[model samples]
Target: MNGRMIYLIGPSGSGKDSLLDSARDALAAQGCRIARRVITRSADAQGEAAEVVDPDTFARLEAEGAFAMNWYANGLSYGIPRVVDEWLSAGDDVLVNGSRGYLPEARRRYPHMLAVLLTVDHHVLRQRLHARSRESAEEIEARLARNAGFAETLMTGESDDLCLLDNSGSLAQTRERLLKLIAEHRLPD
Candidate 1:
């Protein structure tokens, strides 16, 4: 079996983490591994369930070529550990919660990757972000401004490589769609 990566990309408050966690459990029996991201954010961060590393360690790891794809966004560094590539090579389907800013590089590294972009209703997004309470008002504003461009690209289909999902509905709806997509795109022997 050839490796096929499933990359989930979305902005803050888009429910990417929740959706990924649900799908991870649902797909575990099928041998899918959810790749844990390495981040410069502290472990105490509220929303993202990532492996937190300091700047020095992150630089050392990046210098050692440990990350498959890494990027700086919202003043923080994020990386998908190279172990995901290893898992995929072993024929296990690996799911990654990736960054929109780094999608091009991720595609170049794993062209066959199934990229899923999750979006949310503007009102819902605002509510979710407020509830998360992870950042100051200024930071939240910056995030919304950044997210707008990504949303526009999805609406315009500039990202034809991605399967778009509006997560304004129940999570079950999103999960089933993703499972179906994976089944449809399953690699042939």
Candidate 2:
């Protein structure tokens, strides 16, 4: 059987990176591999452990068909390496930190993929974004508003493969819930 794709998406400050980091080892033990994304950003950027590449390099890679998935968001280009295809074909589940706007395309590509939406309370999300210090207060507020709208849309037009995981309180609790969610979706042998 082919392995499932867990496409994780969330707002900027939703703790997707943190949850993925905390659950990495456990997920690996359960045969799930996290795909390291290639992004057009600095290596020292304070977020996910994505591969940093210059715009030229990213263009080259994209031209060469090195990515199974690619999208531009927040003024940066992100790509999921095509190696994920190999892992999936070998029966190893793959999890990707994915884009909310690009989700429809992702779902089209992997129809059976599980869409995990990591969410946080509005206040908690605001605090977290502020703590990052990346965006101004106005930008953060705008992000919060967008997030709220997106969450509402998802709740109303939910799909069978979509799952919502709240990351507002404790990372430990969220990690446990995430593991359980993945386990529940695992394909039977």
Q: Which stretches of candidate 1 lie over 4 Å from their true place?
A: 154-158
* Per-residue lDDT value at 187 in model 2: 83
Residue 114 deviation, candidate 2, in Å? Answer: 0.8
lDDT of 1 by residue, 103-158 (tens): 88888888888888888888788878888888787888778887898778666754
Model 1 CA lDDT for position 135: 73
Report the number of the highest-TM-score candidate. Answer: 2
TM-score, per-candidate, Cα-based: 0.92, 0.96
Over 4 Å off in model 2, which ranges? none
Name the weakest run of 10 consecutive residues (lDDT summed) in model 1.
152-161
Taken over the whole model, the C-alpha lDDT of each candidate is 0.84, 0.92
Which residue pairs in model 1 clash with each other? none
> Alpha-carbon error at 100 in model 1, in Å?
0.5
Candidate 2: TM-score? Answer: 0.96
**Model 1 Cα displacement at 63 (Å)?**
0.8
Model 2 C-alpha RMSD vs. true structure (Å) is: 1.2
